[model samples]
Target: MARPLLSAHAERRTSVDYPYSETMYASVHHERRAAFGAELYGALGIGSGDHTARAVYDAESLRFYGAPHAAFLFVQGDGEARLAADVGAYMQTLLLAMTAYGVDSCPQGLLSFYADTVRAELGVTGGRLLVGISFGYADASSPVNQVKTERAPLESTTAFHDQGPSSESVRP
Candidate 1:
C-alpha cells in the first residue's frame, strides 16, 4: 500500500496550490519554516544553494521517510478553518500518544498538497485532507534524523491578560 501511494505521489509530483489563503502563513511562520529547512538540509551536508539536493531530500516525505506505516487524516467538509483546527488538535493528541508508546511519527503537511492522488489511491471520498502522519521506529543513525529545529520562546508566542483592564483603559 505504501509503495503504490509513494509511486502515485511521485508520478504526480506537481502539488496543488496551497489550499488556504496566503495570509494564513504569516511572516513568523515563514521564518520558522525557513529555519527548519536550513537545519534539516544542513544536517545532510546539503548547501542552501543546492536546489536539486533540496528537492531530493524533500521527496523523502512522499516515501514516508522509510517508515513502515502511514496514516492520512481527512475531515468531512469544504476546508473550513474550524474543522482544520479540530483536526490539528486531534493530530497533536495522536502524535503524543504515539510518542508515549515509543512509536516515532512525523506529521507531513506536504501530503495534503497531493490530496487528489491520496484520495484516488486510498479510495477515499468526501473529505478535505488535513495531514498525513508516518509512524514507525526512527533510524537514529541517519543524519537527517539528527536535525533539531529550535522553538520560539513562550513569551514570543503567548500573551497574558491575567490582570483586569489597565488603569489607563476606559470601561464601558
Candidate 2:
C-alpha cells in the first residue's frame, strides 16, 4: 500500500515569492553542489560512486529531525541575504546555550522544505521560513545521533596575503 505524506508541499502548490538565502541556489548552478559533494558525502561514509548508500543516508538525514522540540526561523519575504546572516548568528547562540545546558540540538535546512506545514500550524505568514532547529536532551543510544562529519582545513577555504611583502606572497 502507498502511504501519504502529512505535509507535502506539492499538494499545496504555493508560489514561493521569497528566495532561498543561498546565492548559488538562486543562481541555479548545479555545479555548486558538485563542488562540496566529496566533502559532504565522505563525512557521511558514502563511498565514491556508491549511489545507493548516498541515497539512503540522504533520505535518512532529511527525515529524522533528531530532536523533540523544533524552532523555526522565519524572515520577512523582502528580507535580503544579510538578514540570514543575523539569523544564523542568533541560531548559533541558541545552539551554544543548548550545549551548555546538556541539551542536544540539530539544525536542519531540510525543515524549510515543508514551509506550508509550519505556516498552517503556527499561523505564520508574510515571511520565509529559512531554517528549523530541533533541541532536546539527546538519546545517546541512537546510532543516528553518533554519526559524525569532518570539517575541511581552514586554509583550504581561506586565502591570506602579506601586505608588507612581495606581490607573490599569497597563501591559500
Candidate 3:
C-alpha cells in the first residue's frame, strides 16, 4: 500500500496534540522495547550496547509521543555500508511485524548523527560511528504519522542486461 503524508503545516498540528503529559504518555505502557531490541541484537549475532531512547505510545491517539527507544553504534569498517543496509531492512521488517500485534513504528533515520558522542558515552573503540532505530507504536495523531516518504518505482530503478545467448535482467 502507498504511504500517507501531510498536506501542509496547519494539518500537522491536529495530528499530535495529545491531551496527556509526557509522563502520563510513558506511563501507559509496560513494554520495555529497548530491552527487547538489545535481546534481539544479541540473538541475531549483532553486538549492542546499553543505550536506549524513550518511546511513547498512546492508545487513544494511536500515536507514539516520544523519541527513539534504542540506539546501536558501529564503527567505520569495510562492511559498514552493507551491514547498515542489512540492519535497516531487517529492522523495518521487524517493525511491520510488530504492527500485526497492534504496534506501530517509524524508523528515525535522521537521529544517526550522534555517533561520536554515542561512542564516547558507550566507550566503544575503533572510531566507529552510530546507527539507531526509533521504534514504538504508531501515533495515529502525530503529524509524522501523516507524512509519507516515497519509494522508487520498479520500472524506474530496475536494469536489464543482455547475455548475448540469452537476455538477463537484475532488479534491486
Candidate 4:
C-alpha cells in the first residue's frame, strides 16, 4: 500500500504541505459543510445541539473508524499551491482505485491537525503531512454508512464562459 502511494507521489513530481487556506471553508462552503455535518449526525441520531454526541462522533476519526489499515500522505518540500493541487489529484485517484478493489476508505483532514505527533511517532523528517486515509472492509450494516449528503448542483457551482448567457453560470 505504501509502495503504491509512494510511487504515485513520485510520479506526480510534486510535493505538498497542508491542503487548506488559513480560512479553511468560508461563506457558502462553510454553509455546505455545516449542512453535511447536520445530515451526518442526524443519521447517527445526534441532534445539532448535542455537543457531547458530536464530540464522541468526531473522535471516531482518530480511531480511523476501526479500520485495520491506514495511510498517511506527505510531501517533501515547503508549502506550494501547485504541489498541493497535485497531491489532491493523487488522493482522488488513490481513493478511486481503492473503491475498485472493494476497499472502503475515508479521507481524514483531522489527522493533519496532529502532523507533528504523527511525524514524531513515525520517526519521519522533513515532510509536510497532507492527509491521512483510513481503509478496510466496510460494515454494510452500519447506520453511519447510510448517511449521504446532498451535492450542490453544477449550475450553482460552475461557471461557463464563451458559450452564451443561456448556459449555466454561477455568476449573478
Q: How do the predictions measure up, each by TM-score?
A: 0.83, 0.62, 0.43, 0.78
Ranking by TM-score: 1, 4, 2, 3
Which candidate has the top score in TM-score? 1
The sequence of per-residue lDDT tens digits that candidate 1 reaches over residues 75-163 is 87666778878888999999999999999999988777887777878899768777889999999999988988788999999997787
Cα error, candidate 3, residue 10 (Å)? 27
- Tell me which residue pairs clash in candidate 3: 5-148, 15-141, 62-139, 62-140, 63-139, 63-140, 64-139, 75-128, 104-138
Model 2 alpha-carbon drift over 4 Å, by segment: 1-5, 9-66, 160-172
TM-score of 2: 0.62
Candidate closest to the true structure, highest lDDT: 1
**Displacement of the residue 42 alpha carbon in candidate 1, Å:** 0.9
lDDT of 4: 0.77
Residue runs of model 4 more than 4 Å from their true location after superposition: 1-22, 162-172
Residue-by-residue lDDT tens digits, candidate 4, 103-167: 99999887676666667667888778889999999898898899777889999989977765665
* Total residue pair clashes for candidate 4: 0
Q: For each candidate, C-alpha RMSD in Å?
A: 4.8, 7.7, 18.1, 9.4
State how far residue 88 of model 3 sits from its true place (Å). Answer: 3.8
